[model samples]
Target: MTSASMISPGDILTRAEIRPILGGSAYGGICPAIEERNVILYSDHEVAKKFGYHDGWLSENDTLGPIFEYTGAGKSGHQSLTQSGNKAILQHVQSGRTLHVFTRVGKITGTDTKTHRYIGEFAIDEEQPFVPRQGLGEDDLIRTAIVFRLRPTGEFDRSDSDTISPAPSTSAEFVPLTITSDMLEAAAVTRNAFTSSSLRSRSNSASLDAAASGKIAPVQAVNVSEFQRAASAATTVRRRKALLIEAYVNQLEAQGHSVGSFQLQIEGRTTTLRTDFFDATDYTLYEAQGSSDRDAVRAAFSRLLDYRRYVRHDGLQYEPKTVALLPGRPDPDLEALLASYRISLIYQGEDGKFSSAF
Candidate 1:
């Protein structure tokens, strides 16, 4: 990817492919914008401060990643999300827009000669999506911030694109350097010295230029307290979603339909795809999106598509109807959007009413 010195909230068209924009520039020559405005430039560096887990990236899995800590839509007491200054940033995620991501290379703070590695375009991880979590700002005020999970659009774009190659967390143990026969023979006489020397060399190279590598620096222990708080918040969201699924399942059962959760195991695949509800009578698979937000809805759509593909690949006896089940009615435009894709939407009402958009 061509490494532009800067990119902002609305710079790229949502339809343009990422490769052309970035020219496959993985890392290096690109620094976390040495500055940021509305569009978050996430270069693997943790902020210079020791306190808050304000801005950073967490690649939870190859497919699921999270960006922290932007305030969410003004639903809760998250004033930051509602501020006019951040409106463009919030819309990018809420509207299912992709953003450019770069990881830090050398120290990027307090200096003008910093650089970043372009990771690639990332869409917010749709499955768990964004969660409102407890976080303290630099000012120490209690606030709810939005943490968006992101997933790369294509393969890793940087030299260090191994995603977890060196392991991103500050807590990552010093991974020993791989030894070759040539180095082994020379170091045999002084193994301890060789090992320590090699480790230091690798660490130094990873830091990339001790002078420019800002103390804001690369990945931290992922903020222990923040990790715990995010985890707890996710658990709560899951529990609430489960209840909504149960309610929907009960409603279907009462209507004399036979429905059950379905799990599909594909040969040679370690992970099995699971569906929220499967109706045997109609061979319909329902995917549950606990929230009515855009990312969640879009993520549910992606999952349903994946399930449909995997089930077909599994050679099921019958084709299945894919429906997205939501806990509450989403935006009216979202319903129309779902219909446009030929995916049905069924949502629960505030009074526990259910309606379907087919």
Candidate 2:
């Protein structure tokens, strides 16, 4: 409502947050130089070249490198984005989520007499908010704030020749050597003899019977069903519920949707997971695309059967019947349009694991 809150410092950025900054568009068209410029600065010159910034603007190149590349102009008419401008853009994107800013300072050596110092800094913001233009109200504003910094490094000699010269040669030189098969065979024989002698000594000193000592007992085989029963009984139901919710969140994130909240309805049980995230706020469940709900359900059930086989448990299994459910409508048989995946529901009892019963 109040444009969320500013992203707090010290938060680790997630893939969702990094995606937009790396290249995702906020309006309609892509930001031309931003992506290429970032690639040049953070990645290799080749990568930047792929994006059309081939001049090595951020690296070894003199005039076109990142150090000399102007992002935003200063008040003095220089074309370089101020530290504040970069921060603002990042913050605007974050929409008050958690963000992390990293700054580093290093020295660059030059081949000539003149030396220069520079700074390197970057920021990663998480869970930024986004509202569609169609959803905007007269007073409702879309704000993006970027949290970033400028890291100034120490100065080093900056000679034009330094850029052209190759890296300094190491003091020690490695020499190539060749060995014959006979030498290898002799070494292998000596190693085998030592190993044989060690084995012989151990065998001579060891007793065969348990009472005499040095006797190793064979491990007993465990009953698979019994182990599964014990494992299921020991697991906490609450933890399973948490896992289910986490799986949903991860799935949505993978689909490029920022999940804000989710409601899990299990009969009379209702659980909700909420966040002030951007993008999708509601969703409808559907069966996998191009598959019937019954078939989709069967596939999910098959996976459950495979899981049972893995745990060595035997039981009569039933496939879950899946359907599409909108906000308020009868479940539909249209499964061909929805994405589907298996999600564990819970460890219902000692003998079985419960999963999405849909």
The CA lDDT at 103 in model 2 is 16
Task: Report clashes for each candidate as comma-separated counts.
Answer: 22, 34
TM-score, cand. 1 vs. native: 0.36
lDDT of all the models against the reference?
0.44, 0.23
Model 1: CA > 4 A from native: 1-232, 312-318
| TM-scores, each model vs. reference | 0.36, 0.16
Q: Candidate 2's residue-wise lDDT over 224-297, tens digit each? A: 23223333211222123223333434555677864331112122211111111112323221211112235433
Instruction: Kindly state the number of residue pairs that clash in model 1.
Output: 22
- Give lDDT: candidate 2, residue 303: 37
For candidate 1, give the lDDT.
0.44
